[model samples]
Target: MIGIADYLDKQLRDYGIKEDLSILDFGCGQGNYTIPIAQIVGGNGKVYVIDKDKTKLNQLLVIAKKVKVDKTIEILESEGQFDFDLSSESVDLVMLFNVSCCIIGQDNYPEFQKLIHELHRLTKKDGKLIIGIKEGKTMLNRVETGIPLISKEFKLDKKEKGKYLDGEKLRNGIFYSLTKK
Candidate 1:
């Protein structure tokens, strides 16, 4: 199994995110990536972790406290949608790892467009947004459809596929690094 801390460092190195960069992990499940990022960012930087489920947040809090990493992660219990609940243009990076489908639901319907718009709203100018998901027809097709929605508000900086971290292959999943123009 890939350790969360190692995975976080590898991903950051791969993506070229440096120290002092603030990040938001949308749908961060139970501090899997959150704890590692907290350590990676050090005391100077911050990580905002948002999830729709309160139980998961509580569990993450416990893990953070037990591991002495609670101070680095800001746990936000998303009450409405997967909204960040932070000030506009505040974050440096928004990480949507395996979260797009969960937020939009797996129904393969049309409501996902709104989620795409919301992602655009939360990102800052020049801020990078990274999204990762499994290989699936629905996810692949949704990315194709959602690209147009995001393009309306931001410009794509880079698009990559088959990127792997900690023995995990991103496969059909795509990570779109977009900047608000």
Candidate 2:
């Protein structure tokens, strides 16, 4: 049986997460994508993972060390808000997979959009941003309303059928690859 990390790393490579690129996994929880992405990016690259949850951050650190990819990652703790201290336009890729889809409802959509705008600040002029939204035709806060606000902050470069990390499983979702406009 394929473990969750192995499965996710394969999915990430298939989705074209390249090597030697600095990345930010915002709201990173428990090293799901953080560990695999760190491995993919290798020794020359870095994955800056930020999460408000201490437990999750600690768990992720443990996993990273166990996987021998801890050197490629820089773990950070936040106050569970939109604010960040990273320098502007520092990373090659920014990933918000499975982070925005949950809280974006009929209301507070603006707040979610604000987060996207902040991401825009963190992305390099030629860098890419990736998001994974759950598959749905009618838009349960995933398809319809989410993209427009994000479009304001990023240009849709490409999209691929991919899985987002959900707990110990990889769930069905679409990965949107966007670049600055």
Q: Quote model 1's TM-score.
A: 0.80
Per-model TM-score on C-alpha atoms: 0.80, 0.86
Q: Write the residue-wise lDDT of candidate 1 on 17-88 in tens digits.
A: 666668887878776667767777777778888887888899989988998878878876577463556777
Which candidate leads in TM-score? 2
How does candidate 2 score on lDDT? 0.79
Question: Which portions of model 1 miss their true places by more than 4 Å?
Answer: 1-7, 82-84, 106-113, 163-173
Residue pairs with colliding backbones in model 1 are none
Ten residues in sequence with the least summed lDDT for candidate 2: 136-145
Model 2: how large is the Cα RMSD against the reference? 2.4
